[model samples]
Target chain A: MLVYLIRRIGQSIMVVAVMATLVFLAVFAVGDPVAILASPDADQRELEAITTRLGLDRPIYEQFGIFVWNALQGDLGRSFVYAQPAVDVILQRFPATMELALAALILSILLGVPLGVIAGLKPESLLGRSIMTTSIFGFSLPNFWLGLMLILLFAVQLRWLPASGRGETVEVFGVHLSLFTWDGLRHLFLPALTLSLYKASLVIRIAQAGTREVMLQDYVRFARAKGLSYNRIVFVHVLKNMMIPVVTVLGLELGSMIAFAVVTETVFAYPGMGKLLIDSINRLDRPVIVAYLMLTVVIFVIINLVVDLLYAAIDPRVRLTESKG
Target chain B: MSKAVLDVKDLSVSFRTREGLVTAVNSISFSVGAGEVLGLVGESGSGKSVTGLAVLGLIDPPGEIDPRSSIKINERELIGLPEEKLRRVRGKDVAMIFQDPMTTLNPVLRIDTQMIEAIRAHEKISEKAARERARQALEKVGIPSADERLKAYPGQFSGGMRQRVAIATALLNRPTVLVADEPTTALDVTIQAQILSEVQQLCSETGTALVWITHDLSVVAGLADRVAVMYAGRIVEEGPVSAVLEAPIHPYAAGLIGSVPSRNKRGVPLAQIRGMTPSLTNLPPGCPFAPRCDYATDICRSTMPEPTPYEGGRAARCHHPLSAPTPAAA
Candidate 1:
């Protein structure tokens, strides 16, 4: 087991290295770094100074080495556009996006899985068929479009909630609350719901297909023959078997949530890493772009690792294989 | 004879597909006496597994069972029972072991979790007791280190071991009726033989009415007390194992018996069934096997014969049952 874990950790390090290299290349590959510094008002000396200060005057390899070293040492350099520390900029904006994505994920799992399971168990029933058809529509509708629809219906028509931002004012327990937690959740509802619409459909389809496949398995038949209640069979036996593929989808979806939330974030005018990354890209903010890209890579790798661990917990066979290797 | 443990009468099932309502199991009647292993032999889509599934009320929706279909276990009608009540009957009074052992056991769960779940599903047993019974059941099925194996996942075990675990699960409740649908089909020959003998012994010892559904005639011949030959959706022939194997009266049965490679002596060419069974949808007029049977005549092709009793506890469904020319002697 120890040997297996060591191997997996070794593989994880390699994967992270590959991801870092890719992010570095992608950030630099888009356009000339010196062009942004060269403006109509800037003279030759100013251009040289800006280039030297930003380390663009050095060899590409040296620049990349410096970037990696500083990134590893918790120094993400300064944003070219924001003129603030890239790490600070990311940290300031990350919580809002995280809160929104987390809410969306939770809602998807809560609403989509059960609906999918019901649809799969009774494919011919009116409720089941209706749920399936609605899920298909849900999947086809884009997140940004869904966000717009929610804004139109709930924000414009109903006036029940604010259209955007973390809320007008923040207070908790008769005290001024932080925008990161309570206020963020209040303002995040519409965008989160929009984000959840597509994700919920995905989760439903995956869960439904998975549950359907599991239901057809011989063991399910065995369980039925054993006189296990329909509820027990569906929830206990079928759900457990169906979770393998569902977990895989959920994990990938979670990783993609940070990236996929770009359009939704833009629509809501929300302050998140996704919005920060997009703004940085538009202004050719290399440092902030690289930092955000690295963070996205980290999130993807970390979530996948957590999912692998979850897989191990769910199935001893995977654990055994890990141990054996 | 002992009292009938499972009495299935006029059981029929049909699926509402895009094409039409395709009949999977026609009105078939059979009874399994307590402590007797009735072998249900058929090829793929012969409705053998469907019949077994129907008995437990496990048939999914869109596949409708005839209202007249009646399945009684220990004189209790199971057909049309609500899902809640049916759950109590299944795995308690009647349990099934499916064909693929790998899929029969939940892949993600440990043997202990699955087995104990099965045990506690019907009984109000403590976890400790359930665990102990699971271990005992595994041991009973000849699995070495049963306690250790209980903690292992289904994928951790070999195919044969998984089948043993599945069998152990079925026997955990000491069900009155045990339906094993090609349980040993996925195992190696030696493992299949071992499992077959073990199941046969367990059934007889516990007085459980066993229905061993398989395509292997030889396996059933050695294990079952009585055998039923299903063709398409109906039982074309049924009788004592000895009577059916030694002298099959039905043309399909004779063809099936002749097709067994082992039945031929050394240096003799193996006999093969001439044609495939007719499709369930758009079946030929009259007999389902008429298109396949070489001995089928105008009368055989025009009229489906009802199952007629033969001497010495045997039955056959054929218009000219005794008219076939004898094959070269073995």
Candidate 2:
């Protein structure tokens, strides 16, 4: 297991390095930060001064070398707008995105698994048909559109929830968190719901398909023949076996969830890393953009590693490799 | 033989398929007494396994058990019983072990969990008591290191060991009837004999009515007290294992026993039953086995033969029952 972990960590380092190089080249290849940061009325000499001050005058390779050197030494440069370390600026906003992703994942599992199992258990039933139909809609609808629709329905007309922004954060062990307070959850709901609908649909499809297939396995029939109650057979036997595929797919989905919370965050104007990323892009905040991209890459790597470990844990056949078949 | 512990009468299992109503198990009547093993012998598609499933009330739709059929355990009717009551009857009164032990036991769950569930599903006993019974059951099946083995998963066990675990679980509740459908078919030859003996010993000791379903006549020859031979969906012949093996009245049964490698002359070609089982969706007018029977005549094609009893307390479903004289009881 330790060897496996070490190998995974080594792979993650390679992934991070590749991502850093791509993010650096891609950011530099796009619109020049000088044009966006400098005033249009500025004289040529003044523009030159600004360019040199931001180190734009340096050669591309030289600039990349300097960036790499500082990045390796635990400095991701400083954000132009926040006037803080780019890593720190992004980290400050990380919590909001983390909370949103966690909430979305929880909602997806809680709602998707049971509903999916129901659909799988009785595909011909009216309720099962309706659940599957609704899941299709959830899967097809765009995250931004769903976010806007949720806002219009709940916030605009009903006036039940705050339309935008994180509400009333309370300190929890020296970390700011809005999820604990009722007002905060009210704020978190629309955005989290928007983020989760597609994911929930994915879960539903996986669980439903998985449950349907697992239901036909001989063990399931054996379990039934053992006089296990309907609930026990479905929940214990079917659910455990079905969860294998679900976990693999969902683990991969989670990385994309945290990375792509961008669209939902933008639609709801939720203050998170995605919203911060959008603002940094608009202002041509090169350092913040680079740092955010790099962090995202590292996070994806970590998630993949954790998923492999989790797979081994859930499936005994995987963990006990030396055992006879 | 002891008094009947399980009696199945006119049990017919059908599947509604695109082709039409396909009868997998035609009206079949048989009984097993406590401490007795009845080997149900047949070909791949011959309804023997279906009969085993019907005995456990497990014919899931698209498959259905005909309402006209009856399955009784201790004289308690099982056909048309509510799912709730049927479930209670299963695993408790009648447990089943399947063909592929690799698939019979849930791979992810530990051995103890599966065994304990089998016990607790019927009896409302504490987990501790169930665990103890599970442990003892494992030991009964001759699995060494009972405590450690219980903690291990199915994949950890070999194919033969896995089948033993399945047998142990089936016997956990000391069910009155145990339906084992080709449970040893997937095993090695030596493993097959060992498990065959272990199961036979356990059933006789517990007085559990055992229905051993298999296409292997040699297996039945050694293990079963009585044997029923099915062709297509009907029991073509049934009698004491020795009598049927020595002199089968039904031509199909005769062909089956004759095809056994050991029974055939060493230099001659092996005898065989020609023609595949007729599709249940479109059976021939007369006996389902007529197309394959060498003795099939106009009467055999025009009408089916009802099961007829002969000397030696044996029966065969054949208009032209073989004239092989009954041998003296061994």
Best by TM-score: 2
Candidate 1 CAPRI level: medium
TM-score computed on alpha carbons, candidate 2:
0.96
Evaluated at residue A287, the lDDT of candidate 2 is 96
> What class would a CAPRI assessor give candidate 2's docking?
high
* lDDT (0 to 1) per candidate: 0.84, 0.89
RMSD of each: 4.1, 2.3
Query: Can you list each candidate's DockQ?
Result: 0.68, 0.84
DockQ of 2: 0.84
Give the clash total for candidate 1.
5
- Runs off by more than 4 Å, candidate 1: A18-44, A81-83, A137-139, A168-183, B323-330
Model 2 clash pairs are none
